[model samples]
Target: MMSTPVANHEAIEKVRDLIQGIDNAMLTTMTSQGLVSRPMKTQEVEFDGDLWFLTKKDTNKYQEMLKHPAVNVAYVGKSYVSIRGEAELLQDPSKVKEFWNAAYEKLLEVPYDDPSLILIKIKAETAEYWETGNKTKMVKTLFERLTGKESEETDLNKTVDLD
Candidate 1:
């Protein structure tokens, strides 16, 4: 039987927690040649089914997103989360100021008000996560591996819909 979609608040919060601990994510985008992946610093904010990042409008990633908005973002923390989403490029000055930080001065070597600076908003459609267990469970899993027996606790993988 097909499993029911996970659209509850608990599932969304679980995804937010997993991604909150991750500082960087590999954003995969499509290109004419093939798929290109880049490491992007995630904006620090409460996750609510969307993600944000800063980039330049002239960059190849921006062009690729314009061509193909479908993207995948993978985060690795205590758990692993893979998010499939659609990306939109935005240049709203107020939002730029809202998400801006002093660190951008050092990283971008320019003020936040620079016209070239832009934001990428990814509206997540679905997210899947693999959460590892605690030390006791880890030990049990190790024993099971050594004994060539499958473990009973195998419900760590979950997929949540962010629609």
Candidate 2:
């Protein structure tokens, strides 16, 4: 129930650090069938209030984002971060080249100039993160849970407003 709003530069850096360690994230989109989530490789760039991903323009995810721009991206590592954001499909060739690499060429089997290649820019609005402490603290939490005792830890959860 403890949620601190992160607005300072230091706090923002901490959030960015946590996300930098996570290589992949689950992107959830709303469709006629309900909510659909798929694993997507996170772009290796400094987090600056937004996230980016590369996907085919003809994919269902691209269509879904067009219909319902609202999406959620979940990341897990030493900490868990849940970001609620809006996605926009961009065809900026310069941006594509900025994030392009040899790995992308191997995966798509096509050059960066391919027509189907597009970028998904997610502008994060609000994000919540839960960071767990070291092994000793984790063990204590487990012990408290097993004994049916309420643990007293209030500094592990935080929320940031990126807008």
Candidate 3:
């Protein structure tokens, strides 16, 4: 089922916090045959309800996004975040240069100025996240479960609207 959409600032902040660090995210795109997922380097920038990734114009994902813009990006770390959004293929050279670095140069073996290089901007619509809280919260949750009670401490998973 799809999450109820709410443009709450706190939820957006929570999402940004959950995905702050960690480098890569699994970008899943809809193909003509089925769904395909691949690990792409998550750009080291503020989340702000949107996600960005660098790619080549000739990649299959580029074509998939053109045909079907819906996509999911999953981040696994201390917290797990699954973000759903509509993908847009961008051809701004200046923006690409802004996110370029030595690692991308070494990994992609393509210069930032390459004409084929492009940016995939995911305008996130809804996000669901699971966070592993501190020991105190875990203990509280355990106690609540033992006592047959439900509380905020026991609720570690939630769906947040991004758009």
Best by TM-score: 2
- What digit string (tens of lDDT, one per residue) describes model 3 on residues 52-132? 999998889999999999999999887889999999999999999999999988988899999999999999988998786
lDDT of 2 by residue, 37-136 (tens): 9999899889887899998887999999999999999999988889999999999888888888998899867788888899999998778888765857
Please name the candidate that would achieve the greatest lDDT relative to the true structure. Answer: 3
Task: Supply every candidate's count of residue pairs whose N, Cα or C atoms clash at under 3 angstroms.
Answer: 0, 0, 0
**TM-score of predicted structure 1:** 0.83
lDDT of 2: 0.86
Writing each residue's lDDT as its tens digit, candidate 1 over 46-138 gives 898889999888789999999999999999878879999999999988888888888877887778889999999999888998776575786
- Please, what is the TM-score per model? 0.83, 0.84, 0.83
Regions more than 4 Å wrong, model 2: 1-11, 135-148
Ranking by lDDT: 3, 1, 2
Q: For each candidate in turn, give its C-alpha RMSD to the true structure in angstroms.
A: 3.4, 3.4, 4.2
**What is residue 162's positional error in candidate 2, in angstroms?**
1.3
